[model samples]
Target: MKILVPLKRVADPDNANKVKVNAGKIETTGLEWKPNPFDEYAVETALRLTENGANPKARLGEVVVVTFGPKETESTLRQALATGADKAIRIDATDDQLDGDVVARALKALVEKEKPDVVLAGKQAVDGDSNQVGQLLAEYLGWPQATFAGSIKSEDDKSLLVGREVDGGTINVRVGLPAVVSVDLRIVAPTSVSSKHSPAHKYPEGVRFAALMAIMAAKKKPLTEMKLADLVSDAALKITYTGFELPPARKAGIKVASVPELVEKLKSEAKVL
Candidate 1:
C-alpha cells in the first residue's frame, strides 16, 4: 500500500512555557522546531501499515511524507525519511502564508498527482489546535474518511478496518483504499497496527528512533520541493490570525492555617461554599 503522510513542524511542545505572545502574534525568535507529536504518530502508523509485523525493516510498499514550510522545514521531512519514509516532499511556503483550507486544497492536488492509496495525517497541528485539514482534504477529494483512528488492520491492501476513539467509546469503521485517515495518540501503541503481510506482533510503544546509519542515509534519499502556487491557484488564506496574547497570570496559592480557615476562604473569598 502506498501512503502519503502530511507532517508539520511546530515549536517544541516541551518548552511551550517559554512561548510568548507579542503584538497579537507568537514570538518565533529563539523557538525550537520539532515534528508535531500527533503527526509523528501518523508517520509511525504509515510505516507499520507498509511493512509486516515481523520484518519491519523491509519496505513492502512506499511511504511518502510531505510538509508545508520553507527550506528549513526540509529537516522535518528528513526526520520522517530517516525513520522509514521512502521520499519527502516539501511545499515551499511559510506559516503565515497558509491556512487549513489552503493546505487541504494543496494536499488534494498533491494527492491527485501522487495517486497514493491513502492520505494520512495528524488530527490537528499542536500550534493551531484547529483539527480541520484532514476532514477538509477528504471533503475536497470526495474520499471516505476515518478520523481519530486508534487502531488499524489492513485487509489485502484494499480496505482498512479502523478503530476510532469517540466520546462514548471506540467505534470501528472500514474505509476503502484511496481514503484519508487522521490518527489519535493511542495509535502509537504496540499493537495498534496490523498489516496483511505480517502475522500478529507487537511493535514498541511510541515513534521509532532512527539508527545512525538510517539518519545518514536519509540525506541521500529523494527530497522534492514544490511551489505552493504550482499545486493550488487560489492561495488566498481563508482564515486570518489577528493577534495572539498570553493569558493573564494567576495569583500564587496560599496555605490554610486550619480547616476552619480553609472553609472560611472557600465560602467567602473563593465563593464556593
Candidate 2:
C-alpha cells in the first residue's frame, strides 16, 4: 500500500493576534510558520496505516509527503521526513497563486504520475479552513471519498473501513483502493487507526516523536521539487480576496438597573428580543 499525504505550513495559530490587514490583503511578513495541526494529524494517520506499531522502523508500505509553497516550505517536508515519511515532494509556488481548486487540479496531475493507492489529507487547513481539496480531488479523480474520518481499519490492501463523525452520530463507510480520505482530530487517538500489518495492537496515544538519530537521518532523505506549472496547464485561481478587515472589538459588559432595563437592552441594544 502506497499512501500520499499532503501537508501545509501556516502562521502560528497561537499568534493570530499578530495578523494584520494592509490594504486589501492579509500581511505575511515576519510571521512564524508551523505545520498545520490537522495536516500533521493526517501524517500521523498515514504512518500508523503503513507500519506495525511494534516495528515502526520497518515500514510495511511506503509513505510520501508533499506540500505546495515557496522554498521555505521545504522545512515543513523535512519535518515530516523526520517523523517517518519515506519521501517528500515540494511543489514550487506562492500562496497567492493557489486555492482549493488549483490545489486539487495540481494534485490530480501528480496522482496520475505517482499512482498511489490512497490519498490521506487533513479535513481542513488551519489557515483557510476551506475543507474542499479532498472532496474535489476525489471528484476529479473519479474515486470514492470519506471525510472527517475518526477511525480507519484496513480491511486489506484493497479496501478500508472508515468511521466518520457527523452532526448527530458517527457513520462508517467502506471505500475501495485508490480513494481519498480526510481525517479529523480524533483520528490520532491511540486506537483510531489499524492496518492488516498491525493487527490487534494498541498504539501509543498520539503521533510519535523522532529520535535524535532519526532527525539527523531525515536531513539526508530524498525531497524532490516540482514546478506547479508542470503539473497543471492552467493555474488560475477561482477564489479571490477583495479585502480583509479585523473583526470588531468586543465591548465591555454593563450592569442594568432593573429587569425592565435588561429587557429594553435586549430589545434595543442587543436586538435579540
Candidate 3:
C-alpha cells in the first residue's frame, strides 16, 4: 500500500507571536516554522505502519512525504525524510497564501498522479487553524474521509480500523483503501532528530526562491500538477477569503490573596453563584 503524507510548516508554538503590519495586511513573519504537531503524528503513524514487520501492510511500499510551503518547507520535508520517509515531494506556490481549497486542489492534483492507497495529514494547521484541508482533499478525490483519527491499525490488507476522537468520547471506524485521514496529535509521537536522521542543514539563504526552484525540480521527483478544471468535474466548491481582523486583547485578572476573598469577589462583583 502506497501512503502519502501531507505536512505543513507552522509557527513554532514555543515562541511568542507578533502580527506584522504589511501594506495594511497582517504578515506573520519572523516566527520560527515547524511541522504542525498533529501532522507530525501522521508522519510518525505512517512510519510505524510501514515499520510493522509482523504485519503484511508492514511490507507496504514507499512512504512519501509531501509539503506545500515556502522554500523553508524543504527543511520540514527533509525532517520527515530523516525521520523515516523513503522520498519527498515539495509543491512550490508563488506565496504561502494557500487556503483549504487551493491546498486541496494541489493535493488532489498530486494524488491523481501518485494514486496512493492512503493519504494522511494533520487535523489543522496552526497558522490557518481552518481544519478543513484534509476533508476538502477527500471530497475532491471522491475518497472516504476518516477525520480526527487518534489511532489507526490495519484491520486487513485493504482495510483500516481507526479510533476517532469525538466531542464526548471516541468512535471506532473502518475504512477501505484510497482514503483520507486527518490525524490528531495523540495518534503517534514524532521521532526526534538524531545523528542517524538529521535534516538537511545546507539550505540556501533565500528559502522561498530556492523552494520555488525545488518545486519545479519536484516534477522530476514523482510530482505532478493538476489543473483547476481537472480537479473538479462538477461545480468546484466556492472558496474565498474576505478580511482579517485581530481579536481583542484579553484583560488581566486581579490576583486574590485568599480563597475567601476570591469567593467574595465572585459572588459580589463577578456575580457568580
- TM-score for all models, in order of appearance: 0.95, 0.92, 0.77
Collision count for each candidate, in order: 2, 0, 0
Residues 1-273, candidate 2: write the lDDT tens digits. Answer: 999999989999889888898896889898899998889999999999999988899988999999999998999999999999999999999988999999999999999999999999999998888999999999999999999999999988899999999999999999999999999999988899998999767877777788888889999999999999999999789999888999888897999999999999999999997
lDDT of 1 by residue, 82-178 (tens): 9999999999998878899999999999999999999989998998999989999999999999999999999899999999999999999999988
Worst 10-residue lDDT window for candidate 2 reads 199-208
* Candidate 3 lDDT tens digits, 1-273: 678999888778665256554655656677777788778777766666565423312334577888775566777887766555667877765343456787787788889888888898889987678899889899988999999987677654387778888999989888998899888866652321111112212211211112454444443444333233444344334555555666676888899999999999999999996
Identify the candidate with maximal TM-score: 1
For model 1 the TM-score comes to 0.95
After superposing candidate 3 on the true structure, give the runs of residues whose Cα lies further than 4 Å from its correct spot.
Answer: 16-24, 53-60, 189-242
In model 2, residue pairs whose N, Cα or C atoms come closer than 3 Å (at least 3 residues apart or on different chains), thus clashing, are none
Model 1, total clashes: 2
Q: How much lDDT does candidate 3 score?
A: 0.68
RMSD of each: 1.6, 2.8, 8.2
Write the number of the candidate with greater lDDT, choosing between 2 and 3: 2
